[model samples]
Target: MLPHYAAPIWLKGGGHLQTIYPKVLALPSVCYRRELLSDSTQETVVAYDFIDAPQTHAPVVVLFHGLEGSSHSHYALTLMHMVKQKQWHGVVVHYRGCGGVVNQSHKAYHSGDSLECEWMLQQLRQRYPEQKLYVMGVSLGGNMLAKYLGEAQNLALADAAAVISAPLDLPMASVALEKGLSKKLYAPYFLRSLLPKATQERHQGKHPHLHWDHLLASNGLKDFDQHYTAPVHGFDNADSYYRLSSAKPVLRHIQIPTLIINAQNDPFLPPEALPTAAEVSACVTLYQPDHGGHVGFVSGPFPGNLQWLPQTVLTFFSEHA
Candidate 1:
């Protein structure tokens, strides 16, 4: 049986689905700042900060977005605004090739690419060794962070981690994303944003595995991964990547006070993909909300709408950290 509060969130008025609210929703605008990090690869990750007071050795929260999402995404900006009261520094890590610059390596970020998050943590830690470092990853970002936390498991670098609306089982998520009216509505948007970047990589003469036209022809998440994600990222195929990268197997290994938040109504996740509190690490807390859509947890009926995810996230981080 589903949890008592587990219910799908549908269009509030029972009409057409709307992506954006009528007003700005009483959230502060996110300020964008760019930083250049050099390794073997020269990458520029954009950071979105909400700085109201001086922060010395203060806890910093890093925000990661879903596929095709960036620092400008509504939820990303909303999260930055929500953390201002805690006086926590909010920084959104823009994935390679999404923040207006191509990455030095031909490899693009995949579902289990925790190295990037680790690198970001190392970068932040180098600057503030005494401060706490927390991460909140949404959707694809969530999957990556979960894998990272599981692998890191009590490492001093990551103080706490939270994942909102992650598809723990990538194979199941791939199957879910290929069905129903929702698939038709969501698939094109992701493909449109994803394929062009792959094409650009091909133009740069770096990624031999990327077939620009083939990626453009992909129908869904699975299709895209099969054609683009796996090949370009060193996987045999989509199935291999999904099987190896799923976070479920690693959940038990996570030692930090991690929180996994998923909404039953989340279209991207199959009902079976949801994890139980018992199945995860003792330190991991699972919050499967009654409704939130896929990271869309708006509340109240007003011109100025309010979101529940950001507030809930801050509460989780504060309580754990």
Candidate 2:
């Protein structure tokens, strides 16, 4: 059963503030043990930061981060803290080039990069065969997790999974993010971090043929993904990437228990884009709260914490673990 989420009095109406508030507020710091996994391409490495539970037999939660996010992300740290509190192991998988280090290969991660996720899951399963394992992903990571779950079915890498604020329909989400105040506010913030990484990759001779200046001047994600992400990753364009990567088409194939939480007021995904009961498999649970903008589910009074999301995730994982 889905829990009712009422936004705090101060953050009830505005999506932008709800989305941005928790990110700016301070949270507890988490310590991690970094492990580098060699990419199958052999040109770059993916970094995973592990936060081990005190007990060896505790269940493990594998975390996949959103675009440009790492173990340092607010949600990631908070969840790590929660996992520690429960004496469960947690590992945060840093997408290619997202571990505060530029990847050696020209190819970076995308919303549909299930292969990398599969590799990480395989590693964890092998390393801890006896321990129960669960997976949780946010935003782009959530989309990739859903794609992996649907495609892999019974052979899915984790026992159960949870996805939050995923842009399940990539094209629609992209368009939504590029429109209105979302474009004016959110796009620029993402691009600020993205452009520099693209530039760094270019300087490393990753995509020598492309015009670096033109790529640097990209105003939004669609433009950037078209010029760099698509070409380097072998997609024809952003549209092709979105078409192939979107998780919405494959939801029916998921054979394992999965939880999907989408805030109706998310700035990046319109309510119409969310899936209906007929759209998902029997094993999937779709929880749509009236509020909780984007990844934000801040409750309580002023200076609220993100304990809501972490608690909800842990409870779901506990039931299925």
Candidate 3:
């Protein structure tokens, strides 16, 4: 077994520090080649790639970012840089407007956009037919990809997969985030970006049924999902959306070698909500650390680095491949 992960002593603030460290301090300078790809809905999203010998049959790592996250996210940059160091190709696929491209579709991306996840993987599989393909998803993207794995395991879109800090149980996740620091700090952080685009889309007549006041008045993700996300995505309400979207229900169906790394203390998902070995197929491996909060897995000395998460994920992929 790999060595156990222990948060650096310098990160004394616990989950909060583990969660915010990389996002606030570990951002690095790197270059990427951007490509725009459209889905079945004709909505386009950009993929920022870190490439080395584009035509080589070397392995390819496709990453899916969290809600409102893009290629510029700390996790994306850190992982892609690591991929480059390994001389492997890596690409971060942005979800709709998250890439600053302002998606054309009237509907916004959701927590359970499994179809979109598979569509992107299919495209990547086609582009690199002979190359070994590995997939990694962070937070929201991780949950979506896990759902896709269970629903489309027969397709075998990837040789291996890794999910980081995903909230597999949406209902539980909703309640978790609406309380504590998740509500006070993270909610406003996400709302600043979500409210504006949703507000603009409402003004453009893309969301005619939603109350403008409610969308703008949303204090947390639950309220926003109820007002905008559920209705726009064709779900009856937030409750129904959460019930049908969570990956926990379908984890037993996964057939690919998959690693699910959800910190036991993740603010977004309570310890009780985590799936047990009985809840998953033999192909699924759980790595529930005592720390690492959300997608934050900082390690090293005084000023921690973002290498732990990427190294752990890549090591899993290498083993499976």
lDDT of predicted model 2: 0.88
Best by TM-score: 2
How many Å off is the CA of 14 in candidate 2? 2.0
**lDDT per residue (tens digit) for residues 1-321 in model 2:** 445678988888777788988888889889899999877567888898998887898999989999899998989999999998998999998887887866887678899988878887988898889998989999999999999999998999898899999999999999998898999898788898888888777667677867667678789888888888887788999999999999999999999889999999999899999988899999999899889998999987787889899888888888986
- Which pairs of residues collide in model 3? none
- lDDT by residue (257-290, candidate 3, tens digit) is 9999998888899999999999999999999999
- Looking at model 1, residue 16 earns an lDDT score of 16
Candidate 1 C-alpha lDDT tens digits along 1-321? 112332223345311133334224565676655665542244434333334326676788888788878776778777777766567777777677766666656667888888876776777788667877778898999999898888888783677888988989998988887888657868887888787777777777866646667777888877889888898778999999999988888899999888888877677886678998677989888887656567766665444344566777777778766
Model 2 residue runs over 4 Å out of place are none
lDDT of 3 at 211: 76
lDDT of every predicted structure (CA atoms)? 0.73, 0.88, 0.86
What is the Cα-based TM-score of model 3? 0.96
Off by over 4 Å in 3: 43-50
Alpha-carbon runs more than 4 Å astray in model 1: 1-27, 39-53, 209-212
* Model 1 deviation from native, Cα RMSD in Å: 3.6
Supply every candidate's count of residue pairs whose N, Cα or C atoms clash at under 3 angstroms: 0, 0, 0
Could you tell me how far off, in angstroms, the CA of residue 142 lies in candidate 2 after the best superposition?
0.3
Which candidate has the top score in lDDT? 2
